[model samples]
Every structure is written in C-alpha cells, then in structure tokens.
Target: MTSELSWLRRRADKRAEIGPWELREGLRSRSSELRALLEERKLEHPQGTPEGNRVHRFADEALSELENAERALTHAHQRYKVGSHVAVGQIHIDTAHNLLLRLSRPSEIVSMMPGILAIVQSRLSSDDPRRARVEAIAQSPESIGEPERETILDAVGVARQASIRENLRVRSFVNIVGWVAGCLAVAAVLVALMGAVFEDMVPLCFTPYRGLEVGGYVVVCPVAMNPDPKGGRDINESEASATTPADYLVIEIVGLVAAGIAAATTLRRIRGAVTPYNVPVVLALLKLPTGALTAVLGLLLMRGSFIPGLSALDSSAQIIAWATILGYSQQLFTRFVDTQAQSVLNAVSAPNAMPPPPSPPQGATSSAS
Candidate 1:
C-alpha cells in the first residue's frame, strides 16, 4: 500500500520534479527492497489485495500512462529537443536490462546493491519494480502461483545467507585492526615522550647534548650536524644555545615506518576480497594519516631550530605525536565503519516469510487477470 501510494504521489509530480530517468533507476536498485517487503505480507496472507476493482482501474491507468509516455518520447526525439523525454527512456531501457538480471539472480548482485542505491538521477526501465510488485499483488493470488512464490522466497533467503557468510569471513580482521590501532596509538605516545626526554639527558652524554648550557637549565643537545658557516665558535653553539630540542627527523622516520607497516598489514588482510579499485581506495585513505603526521613533524623540526622553546622540540612535537597517533588510528576507523555497515545488514537479514519468483513479461495483450 505504501509503495503504491508513493508511486502514485510521484506520478502526479512533474517530470521536472522527479525525472523519468531517476524513477527507472530507483526501480532497478530497489527491486529487492520492494520484493522483500511485499513478500512478507503475501506469505502471511497469500491472497490478492483487499481492493478488487481498484486493481483493474490501476492496470488500465498504467497501460494508458505507458502509451502516453511512449508518444511523448517519440515527439521529443522527432523535435531533437535537449529536453526530449525519449533520451531519458533510452537511458532507462538500458538500466532496465541490468535491473532485470539483478532480480533474477539476486545473490550475484547483492554486492551491487550498495552501488545501485547510489545517486543516479534517472531510471532505466519503463516498468519500475515498485509498480511491478504492486501489479503482481493486484493480480489474483493465483496469477503469481504458489510455486513461484516459494521460489522467490527461497532465493531471497539464499541471497541473505550468502551475504552473512561473506561478512563473517572478514569480520575478525576488522575487529583485530581496530584493537591494534588503539594500542599502537598509546604506544606511539609513550615512545615519542621517551625519545623527547633523551634530548634533556646531558649528564648521560648522548650526542652534542653531552655538554651545553641552554636557558637557565643545563641544555643537552642530542645531535648537532655541520654548524652554519656564517657564525663562529668552536661549534655553532650560538643557535644551539637557547634550549635543547628533539630531533624531528627521527620522530618523522619512526612515524612513517609505523604507518607503512600498518599499511602493509592491512593490504595483506584485504588481499583476497578487494578488487583492484579497492587497492587505490585503501592506500589513499591510509596515506592521509601517515602523510599528515610526516608533514607535522617536518614543520616542527624547522621551528625547533629557531625558537627558545621548551626542552625537546617545539610544541609541534606534541602535535606530530598526536597526529601520528591518528595515523595509526585509521585502522580503528576502517574497522569501525565496516562493523557499523555489518550491523545494518544484520538488521535487514531476518524475515517471517519468503518472496515469490518474479514472472516473465506477459504478452502485449495482457494476461494479468
């Protein structure tokens, strides 16, 4: 009833409001959603709708509307108008073919649903699934037949079960990735703090920090390279005087190495399931966190050289530290998203009754009585 009303409501709406192209696409994509919903109702009470004559009336109306739509398309083509409705029909017809295949073998196409339901401004088939489901319902319970109904329901069940199996195979990897990322973030913070503290340890004698006076505090340089030529001292201690700071280069290297290892691990986990396109997708997202931390550390390194900042690098070290944490944090993000997606699928999997196998198109004269 809801589908019928919604279709009718959209019908009254203008071509401008909702293009025929989109209507066709929606039908193609939502065929299963409609079928699944209606199937449940039919199984509980396997008979035609309560409204008898209304079904006949709509059939007549649908036939008339189809003819008018055809005529409008022909006229648009003849006029060569960019606004021609026929071009939209052409698009819909092609889309219809794909939709038909999906309906026939839903298991093969369940993965495609996420793609189909995506935004496509127009529809491909003249007879949308919603309409077909309604018309099928309107026809006597015998029109679809008990046998065909059982077949459809069985197919729906199988398709759903296959999806469950596929997701279950990959779920553990997703969970592991999340937990590991959380742990890596904490570990990265502690390791970076220890590295920074090394910059302050002059008494221990590590690198140039072995002996130096920075601020009122005893500044210990970790490692100072070839000093600048412009300044003179036994060493370029002038710039090195203010305070000791961390070596950003080391920090960035550590972060990159950590993120790279993460990427490699993720790639291995997704190897079998992902297509070539997924490779680009996964790599691109992974780099977002890695590259961000790298740049942050690089920037901090430059800033630390000039400023009389606190021991260890400038505040940017802390910034890079957090960002690197996020770099590793991406593992958590992907796993979390996949888990949420799985939850939604689980919600839709259960059902009370099965759908019927869809019938082939009847002859032009109409045997839908």
Candidate 2:
C-alpha cells in the first residue's frame, strides 16, 4: 500500500512538471500540420499565374509566421521551466497565439468559398453557361479568374482582420481581470498581515451587552484568547485586550475556506474555453481574496452593530461561523463579475471556425432582386 501511494504521488508530481511541456508540444504539432498544409498548397498553386502567385505568397508568409510562433512557444516553455517573470511568459504566449492566428486564418478560409461564388456570380452574365462551372468550383474550387479571386481574397482578408481584432479584445479583457484579481489578492494578504502585526491598533474583539453568568461582560473574538470579563456593565472596544492578530487571520482563513467551497461549486458552470486566457481560473482567484476581505468587513460591521438583529455574537465559535458565512457571501458581490466573464467568454468566437458571413451591401441586394 505504501509503495502504491508513493508511486501515485510521484506520478502526480511528474504530471504537474509536464504541463508546460505538453502545451509546448501541442502547439508544435499544430504548427507542423499547418506548415505541411501550406507547403502542399504552394506546390498545387505555383507562382506561374496571379492566383498561384498569391497562394505562393500566402504560403511563404504563413510559413515565416509559423516559424516565429514556434520560436515564441519555445522561449515561453524555457522561461516557464526557469521560473522567469510570469509577464514574460504571457508576452511570449500572446505573440505565439497572434502569429498562429495569422497563419491559420480559419475564418478567412471558411469565407473564401462563399466569397468566390459571390464574385463569380456577380462577374459572369446570368445567361453564360460558365455559371454552371461556378457552382462546380464552389463545391470544389479547381480554378477561378484573377479578378474574382482578388475580390474573394479581399473579403476574406477583411474577415481575418475582424477575427484578429475580436481575439485581441477578448485577450485584453481576460488580462485586465487577471491583473485586478492579483492586486486584490495582494491587498487582502497585506491587510491580514497588518492586522496580525498591529493587533491592538486593529482589534476585532467585540463585547456584547449581555453579562457572563459569573458577573461581568465577556469579549468574544475570532482568536482563541482568554476572555477578559469587565467589572463594568458592558466592556467597550477600548477596554478589550483579548483580541490578537490571530483574530483577523482566523477570520481570513475561514473566509478563504468558504471561498474555496464557492469556487468548487462554480466548477460545474465553467466550460472549457479554447483561448489561452482562462477566465474561470481568474474569477476563482478573485473570489478567494474577496471572500477574505468580506469576512473581515462583515465581522467589523457586526461588531459595530450595523446589522440590528445580529449585532452581538455570543462566543468565539459564533464569530468564526459568521466569518465563514460572510466569506461565502462574497459570491453575492462576485456573481455579477462571473456573469460578465461568461459573457466575454461567449463573445470569443472559436479561432478555428468561421463566423457567419456579413450581410450583402444594401444596393447590391436590391440590384440582384
């Protein structure tokens, strides 16, 4: 049993180590396939004619871009292995993605067939028997005139440019969200550290009006400190010294636990997105810190008697329970963020598929009618 467990642990560690390498390999394989396709297309359509020349040019350009992308991916993998700056890895990944997008141009390819058919129909007279040839070529593009080819290429180029812009927009949004989440997480950590170091300055102890059975009122705190019972009617905030830095840390920890649970529950809703920017991961990270902050703030609000009915907590357990509740309540605030993230993910059309073609020009449709 021990040997089996050890083997499983080692296997898990190996899997973790290979993650970046797997990504690099996957991209390399894709680049290889694209390169082969480009080479074949170049062979089929030589530079003897205008369309062939264009094909040759596209193949050369795409191959060059593919090489760049492979270089970027290699650099990224190396940096990832060396534990270099995360932003450097991100830049390399973004470059590779952009280069690959240019090379593949799936949207352009999808638009090409229809665009060619449109161009052919527009140029050839309706009575021309060559119209039948247009349909045949549309089914399987064997040949097209230079003029019609240029028009189709122009339209496809426009579609490719639009796809690139859309990709950039989605990438930008994901980056912004990731940066914001990271900042918030840092802020939460700082706040917790500050509270821990300067416990007296930032005490989280609360004294209820209700007195203890013995006589005086006892202060309740998240931390497990001996309660100091005041002889007076009720112990005020200033008089309480039982609260320690652990109080804030305890609440933060509880909130973090709750947030983790929330994040786990949300995994069902998270769909796998094709883009490099993992929005769901970013949102999950955001929730953790937000939950921590909320937990601390929620306790503070309760201590200040902000919430009328739930002003006073009876014991340390009660305080911690409330912290957990408040921590999970971060979902209430972050749900809107989740919704927006989903919308953004949905807006990102698949890079490997074509979007719907644009509507015909106003006058062109009427003219055809």
Candidate 3:
C-alpha cells in the first residue's frame, strides 16, 4: 500500500509539470484510452453486475479528469493572451528607431562639410541655382551672425518634422494594428465569460438521442429536447441552445476588473495628478488606455500559462505589475529617445565642421558648436 501511494504521488507530480502543449497532446491519448477501456469492459462484463459498474465508474472518472485538464490548459492560454497586451506598446520603440535613422541623414551631410564648402566656394561665380543656394549657406553663416545660425537650426528642425510626416502613414498603420490586437485580447476575455451566461440561461435534459455527432465527438445542445408526437424526430428548433464552457465567467470578470484597476494606476503614475495641457490632448487621452491595454495584454501572455502562488489573481496581479512597469518604463524610454535625437543633432553640427567664409569675429554664436 505504501508503494502504491508513492507511485500515485509521483503521478500527481508529473501531472503538475504538464504545460499547455503537453496537456493538449495528452488529451488525445487519454481520451482514446478511456474509450477503448470502456468498449473492452462492455464486451466482457455483464452490464448490471457490480464489477461492470466499477469499471464504468473508473472510465467516467478518467474522462472527467481529462476534460478538467483541457479546461486548465485553456485557462492558461487565456492568461497569456492578457499578458501579451503590454507588448503591443512596443510600437513606440519601433517608431523611435525609425526617426533616429532619419535624423542620421542630416548628421551624414554635416560630417562631409569640408567638401561641400569647397564646392560651394569654387562654384560661387556660376549661375547654377543649386550652387547659388549653397554659396549663400556657406558664405554668411558666421558673417551674418547669430540670426543666420538660428536659420540653420530651424532648417534642421524642419527636416526632422518632414521625416516624421513622411512616415505618418506607416506610424498610423502600426497604431491601428496595436489597437486591434488590444481589442482582440479584451474580446477573448468576453468570449470566455459568455459561456457562463449561456449556462445560466439554458436548462439541460438527459436523453439517449444525441443532437449532433461528427468525428466521434458529440455536440450537445444545452436545452431540453422532447420527441415529436407524430413524426418522432428528436430535433427541435425552439428547444435548442448554444453550448458554453462551464464555470469560466467568474475568472474572466476578475481579470477584466483587474485590467481596469491597472489602467487607473498607470494613469496616476505616468500622467500624475493631472495631465499637462501643454501636450497634445489626443495623446493625453490615449496614454491611460494604451498603458492599461499593454499591461493587460502583457499579463495575459506571460501569466496565463501558470498561476504561480494562487490561481485567479496571479494573472490579474501580473497585469497590474506590467502596467506599473511600463509606466515607469516610459520615463527611461523617453530619455533614451531624446538622447539619440540630441546625439544626432550634435553629429550634424560638429566643431569646425564647416569653415565659415572669412568674416569679422562675432561673440554671440550659437552653442551647438
């Protein structure tokens, strides 16, 4: 008996180790085994005998356990879906990278200043319109003083804006994709809970006539079906009900509420007590929702697979943690992007980078030197 108990404990441990993928494969095996065992027992044993009843009970229990395992796997998949919400916010990083690259173009042009200046000076007498503009740029940059320097800086600013505008369509596409991904995750939670609504509304009846059978699996309607008096058909249009997975609504509700809480917390932390009116109003409105959506998606993707210490809130807490992490993360990311932009600007305006045409010394030069 002690040996048997030890074996059973080992089996339980193995069962605990089974992840979503493993459980899915095992479902097919376990289901086949249960079916075969029942068929063998039915063929060999008398139906009414105690031994036959015991065998049937064992098979039924095994089948029930397999169903439970499938349900647990489904729950894990759902959690991962929620966790991935946070990853959707990665669009910001992608756009930042693209802008940084565009900023490099101006930096590259500035790096070759000596050649450009020489070309402009040599061709200054020519009537070519391009050379004329280049002559104007090369000649009085320092001679005309601080105002001319400011013009150069303004041109750089204009170039950056143009680059951003050029990629507006691509950026917009990314935003739309991100929003759709977030909405799909939210919809998944709703679909999971919708099962409970069906269960509450539909009444079940035990009958020998199965409503639909295909591929050895049966799809049973939740509502009762009575045999037609004259035709004797089992199908009834009015009595049929949609089948829903049982007992998942509570978890779905808890996850959604947790997502909302995480969103509120993120807004409080990132935007502070009040959003700054100086920033774009559209951005201010989106910040809270985007943070919350990313957090919820992140939790779903990461925590759905396992409920660590406890079952339900493990996923919810995961979502909140992601939201908070991302809110703080924006602080670091904002600094990083700014630093990249500044470095590019500096590269475009390096020391003695471009020789100014001979002119009187000016004390009020721009600091970009």
Q: Best by lDDT, which number?
A: 2
Q: Which has the better lDDT: candidate 1, or candidate 3?
A: 1
lDDT of 3: 0.39
Q: How far out, in Å, is residue 134 in model 1? A: 27
* lDDT of each residue in 41-137, candidate 1, tens digit only: 3344433655433433333343344444444444422332322343333333333333233233334333333333221101112243532442343
Span of 10 residues, lowest total lDDT, candidate 3: 272-281
List CA RMSD, all candidates: 18.7, 10.0, 32.8
How many collisions between residues are there in candidate 2?
A: 0
Model 1, stretches more than 4 Å misplaced? Answer: 1-28, 31-156, 168-172, 198-244, 253-369
Candidate 3's C-alpha runs over 4 A off are: 1-182, 197-246, 271-369
RMSD of 3: 32.8
Q: Alpha-carbon error at 185 in model 1, in Å? A: 2.7
lDDT of each: 0.39, 0.65, 0.39
Cα lDDT, model 1, residue 333: 47
Clashing residue pairs found in predicted model 2: none
lDDT order, best first, reads 2, 1, 3
Q: On a 0 to 100 scale, what is the lDDT of residue 289 in model 2? A: 90
List, residue by residue over 1-369, the lDDT tens digit for candidate 3.
Answer: 999999997876455433334333444454455446445544665558886666555545544544544444344324433212112212222232222222223434454345555533332334445445545766544353344434433443343343333234323433454564466556655655554566534322122323333122122322222333333333333224322354233333343454444434443433211110111222233333344344334334433434354222212234344445543343332333234323333332232235456774675465435
